[model samples]
Target: MEKKAVYPGSFDPFTNGHMDIVRKASAIFDRVYIVMAVNSEKRRAFDCRRMQEAMERALADSGIRNCEVSIYDGLIAEYTKHHGIGYMVRGLRNNMDYNYEENIAEVNKLIDPSLEYVYFRADNVAVSSSMVKELRHYGQDVSSYVPPAIAALLADGNTER
Candidate 1:
């Protein structure tokens, strides 16, 4: 059986940390689906399509061939179960992230008992979507934190690329 894993997240702007996880996960899983979760309750900084395009470009540039990027609007647990994907991947930077992710994992398990969670520690603990946004807001270069495509999007300042 082919090993498939789902890495679901908001990915407001795909950061280098996210790229790191994708690079590593693609190595082990036969297929790694980078699912972008769309939550109505949360406000996002960038358009979903634009973010997805940027991510796709970055992933392509990195030569990660075993991954696909898609947008889904619902609970990831339900998405995984409905798609028959058993494993889900997450990235953790610190204790706070672990605690929060663990809580989500528990809830996901309740929703789909067959679902399993895999966690990867981020290469740079300081990289986060919020930090990227803040730095960009201050007119600081965030190229080091986010992927090149994402950095271009951020530097463009809401203009379509």
Candidate 2:
């Protein structure tokens, strides 16, 4: 079976930390789907289209051709089963995230036994989507945290790519 994984997140702004996970996952999986999950419980600063566009541009610029961006609604396990993907990639910024992801992983495992979660810890947890968003909100340049293409978008005072 082809080794494919789903990296699901809101991705309000695709950060370099996200790129790092994609780059790493590319080495192992034949394909990585950067899934933009629209969970009603979480709030987002940017819409899915803008996030998808930024991701597409970043992927092209970063030369990560093994991955593709797609939007999905409902449980990720269901999405994975529907798409025939067996692995899910998740990024953890800290122990707090791990605590949360661990429970989610258990739930997902129960939902689909074939589905597995691959967790990658960010090397620079200080530079996360929340941090970038907070910095940008204060009119600060977040070019170092996210991809250059995305940083340009934030620098432009909007999420246009």
Error of 1 at 46 (Å): 0.4
Candidate 1: segments with Cα more than 4 A from true spot: 159-161
TM-score of each: 0.95, 0.93
What is the C-alpha local distance difference test score of each model? 0.89, 0.86
Query: Model 2, range 1-161, lDDT digits (tens) per residue?
Result: 78999999878788988888888898899999989998888877876787788789999998889998999889999989889999999888888999999999899988889998889878778878888888977888788899987876666545533
State the lDDT of candidate 1 residue by residue for 85-138, as single tens digits: 889999999999899999999999999999988999899889988898888778
Q: Count the backbone clashes (under 3 Å) in each candidate.
A: 0, 0
How many clashing pairs does model 2 include?
0
Please state the error at residue 151 of candidate 1 in Å.
Answer: 1.4
Q: Which candidate is the best by lDDT?
A: 1
